[model samples]
Target: MITVSNLTKRYGSVHALGPVDLEIPRGGVTALIGPNGAGKSTMLTIIGRLLSGDSGRVEVGDLDVVTADSRELAKKLAILRQENHFVARLTVRQLVGLGRFPHSRGRMRPDDVEAVDLALEFLDLTPLQDRFLDELSGGQRQRAYVAMVLAQQTDYVLLDEPLNNLDMRHAVTMMRQLRRAADELGRTVVVVVHDVNFAAAYADLVVAMVDGRIAHVGPAREVITPYVLTEVFGTPVDVIEHRDRPVAVYYH
Candidate 1:
């Protein structure tokens, strides 16, 4: 389980996050949904140890995120941020190999190779593994980056807006893959999604944030209602049953 206590962040005088407490359980997919500037990214980055909280504590399982060793934390959690900038020219395979650095210490062994191959296969990039990252399309590169994170083989995965650059088909594929990871591999999956319908469809739990705080956290059926969606987004949303699942429709 991930325990966050009184976590807060600030920029100058602006309060970005904080005084927030949450408990994310293990072995299921949880989706964080909210409006822009709702601090969804801030919270995910802090939990993944990509960003520091001004005042708070984060514990992934038994490891203290604020004080744990970098390698140890990497072994326990793998994260994919929204922005990725690769300076050096590297092939897809080389980039995925970096995920094994914590385990292999820069020298990849047979198991590391197998992990990379499996991740590539999982993301349907095995045939393109030899291709340079710059040579791939935007969506392909995004998938490659996610594949790198998955190759880490950690128990906890946090993804911030991973659906960016993905088409509808690939987006669904990604969510299904995440669901499978949680159900089959017993991994904890937390994702930030802009589409409420996707969250309602795949997530076992839905965490709704607004104005830098959690507005609601519950099962998809509970949080995806019209009342909650209208409140969280500050807009009118109609909930309709589609194939036995609640789907939020905002477009008139």
Candidate 2:
């Protein structure tokens, strides 16, 4: 389980995030949703150890995120941030290999190569693995970055706006893959999504954030209701039931 306690981030006089506490269980997909400046990205980045929290603690399983050795933490958790800047010229394969650095210490073993291959296959990037990152389409590049994170083969996965730039088909495929990863592989999956309907459809749990704090956290059904969603997003959202699931409708 991932435990967060009184986490906070501040920038000058602005409190960007937290004074928040949350518990994420093992082996399920959880989606975090919120409006602009809601601190969703800040919390996700802090949990992933990509950004430092001004105060408070985050522990993934037993590893203390604040002080744990980063190399060791890489073995326990893998994260994909919202912004990825790869100015250096590198092939998709080489970039994916970097995920194995923690386990292989920069010298990839055969198993590590196999892991890279599997991740490429998982993201349907085996065909583009030889291509330079800058040469791929936006969605393809996003898949490649996600594949790199998956190749790390950690127990916990945190993704920030992973569906960005993905077509409908790819986004559906990615969510299904994440579900399978949770159910079949027993990995914990946490994703930040702008589309509440996607979170409604794919996540076992929905964590709604607003104005630097958690507005709601519960099973998908409980949080996806019109009342809760409308309350969280501060807009009237119509809820429609389809195929035994609740889908939020915000468009007029």
Best by lDDT: 1
Task: Give Cα-based local distance difference scores for all models.
Answer: 0.92, 0.91
RMSD of 1: 1.0
lDDT tens digits, residues 88-189, model 2?
A: 998999999998989999988899999999989988899999999999988888888888888899999999999987899888988988888788767899
Alpha carbon lDDT at 132, candidate 2? 97
lDDT of 1 by residue, 14-89 (tens): 9888778999998899999999999999999999998899998999989999899989999999999978995899
Give the clashing residue pairs of candidate 2, or none.
Answer: none
Task: Please give the range of 10 consecutive residues that has the lowest summed lDDT in model 2.
Answer: 178-187
